[model samples]
Target: MKTYETLVAEALTVVPEILPWDLQSRLEQAPAPLLLDVREPEEYAAMHIPGSLHAPRGILEAAAQWGFEETLPELVRARDSEVVVICRSGRRSALAGRTLVEMGFKQVQSLKMGVRGWNDDGGALEDADGNEVDPELADEYFRARVRPEQMGP
Candidate 1:
């Protein structure tokens, strides 16, 4: 049986991942990739990469398509644009990137290490209001909180 880890691994195989620095460089280029943050709203409100568009994973498919109430016109139009899917630690983004690929997106990639990695790499992060988030505080937010029940049996 495939576990969550296996699913993320499988998704990475089909969805290329971009390192934080590389992604930053790409963003500086003429045509920047659309940064899609798939994390929940609360998580995003706390901190996120600047310019990232929020599209929670729960309704990602609907948000990506046209004619749905949840439809994000930017996402729908980005089907032919370079898209970078992001999440807390990269796992969710990889899964979302795979979905974008299947949804006929021309170019889809996951952010390697996600917002956590970016913060670790000295990248700037912003709150939903566009205020700069303190790196140290962001570190605290991104810290792994594995539960006992989630550990190896």
Candidate 2:
């Protein structure tokens, strides 16, 4: 078995490093991180980090063929690129980031605190393809999907 750091180091050639606020700043400033959201489809639909790409955790599990296969060209292309992942919290992205690194992606990082953290810090929301969503409907969409009881205990 590999140590946690060892596992993390395995795939990452040049690991990405940016907390939620820093990431938000990166998005606003010069170069932006390719924000990857690894949540479920429903979760992503309800809310997600602005400019984030959705490549759910299950898909990420098959990192090798996810991008290379013509059937999933967009996802595959993303796999080959640098990305920073976000989930509800940060654990899943950390694991996924390591997996992405292992799959030969040069850079991957987990956003600290995920989408929840981003929203807390006043980051904007966007659709899966990185387009702005209707602000009026955004809260309704989120409330319908991500209720307190819906979250796991």
Candidate 3:
């Protein structure tokens, strides 16, 4: 079986692009790209980049197909729409980015380091209610909840 690093590395190779935290901040301005957070709902609620749309990795394809409330069907319909996929760390987003590209999204990209990287780079994050999420608190939560194996190599 492939290790997580191997899988992520392979996915990254084929993904169209990667948006670093600094670049993502710039994109958050006018004509913002679609920021899709692929973490679970609970994780997203705990903290996420403001304005990001939530669609867990598992249901991403289905959500796109059936048109859920948060589904960006219009954006997805436009093959070249700038869509950025993100997860708790970069691994899952890389895979998700590959999936989007395979699904015909020409401008799909993954957040280079996910939310953790964003926080490390001083990017702002918010809870589901739009309130700012304290960085330290968020870090503590992640440390407590994330298993070492999940972090990969």
Q: Evaluated with TM-score, which candidate comes out highest? A: 1
Error of 2 at 43 (Å): 0.3
lDDT of 3 by residue, 1-153 (tens): 998789899898887445565555657587677888999999999899887888888888865654566565754564577788888877899998888888877777788868887887778899988999999987876664667899779
Give the least accurate 10-residue stretch of model 3, judged by summed lDDT.
Answer: 16-25
TM-score of each: 0.97, 0.66, 0.83
Q: Rank the candidates by TM-score, best first.
A: 1, 3, 2
Candidate with better lDDT, 2 vs 3: 3
Mind giving the per-residue lDDT tens digits that candidate 2 earns over 47-129? Answer: 78766667788877554364333234444566556578888766667778777776777667888767766766667887756
CA lDDT for candidate 3: 0.79
lDDT (Cα, tens digit) per residue for candidate 1, span 101-123: 99999899999999999999999
lDDT of 3 at 32: 74
Give each model's whole-structure lDDT: 0.94, 0.68, 0.79
Number of residue pairs clashing in candidate 3, backbone atoms closer than 3 angstroms, sequence gap of 3 or more or interchain: 0
C-alpha lDDT (0 to 100) for residue 87 of candidate 3: 89
Error (Å) of candidate 1 at residue 125 is 0.7
